[model samples]
Target: MTETFTYTDDLQIEVVNEGTAKFEDQKPQALIDLKSWISDEIKAGNIEGWLPYNNFESSVTWKIIPK
Candidate 1:
């Protein structure tokens, strides 16, 4: 899915979803929104945290400060 989402040069963030998604007709917007969301998370100081005893959920949170 790398073709669907373009990464910045610095490479300090990652996005993960639990299941399949439909990006048809909104691929660009999805990427833009994803980046913006990540940027906002970093600006708000949201760091990756762990959730013990829950192996079915994702643990990493976005804290990527945009340049």
Candidate 2:
């Protein structure tokens, strides 16, 4: 499966996983990779003023796309 992460707001992140509906079949590693990438981007100052520390209990909305 493929995953896409979009920043819907300063503190809200939306995740769309494509090509499957079964939770058991979904790739857990993909989500972990996405989180790592986002964290790295934030630490690198790529997104100015959008620090993880500033967003308390940020929302992560997940969606699954049917094959």
Candidate 3:
């Protein structure tokens, strides 16, 4: 399962995998289409602040769910 969490600032997104939950210091840098996610969050009014990825933590990790 993918769980997304945000701090006071919404610029950074954290996706956590409940199965493994391994934290890594580096993640594959790429562009992500978060239109739907952002829209949902905005509707709920959870968004707080905005910042560049450079200002956020560069490390993240998620686990594969077993079938």
lDDT of 1 at 18: 32
Q: Residue-wise lDDT of candidate 3 within 1-67, one digit each (tens)?
A: 3444342352445454333333232232232323344445556765432322333553233222222
Give the alpha-carbon lDDT of every model: 0.43, 0.43, 0.37
* Clash totals for all candidate models: 0, 0, 0
Report the lDDT of model 1 for residue 67. Answer: 35
Candidate 2 displacement at residue 59 in angstroms: 22
Question: What TM-score, computed on C-alpha atoms, does each candidate reach?
Answer: 0.46, 0.37, 0.23
- Between candidates 1 and 3, the one scoring higher on TM-score is 1
TM-score top scorer: 1
Question: Which runs of model 3 end up more than 4 angstroms from their true locations?
Answer: 1-10, 19-35, 48-67
- After TM-score superposition, the amount by which residue 18's alpha carbon in candidate 1 deviates from its true location, in angstroms, is 1.6
Flag clash pairs in model 2. Answer: none
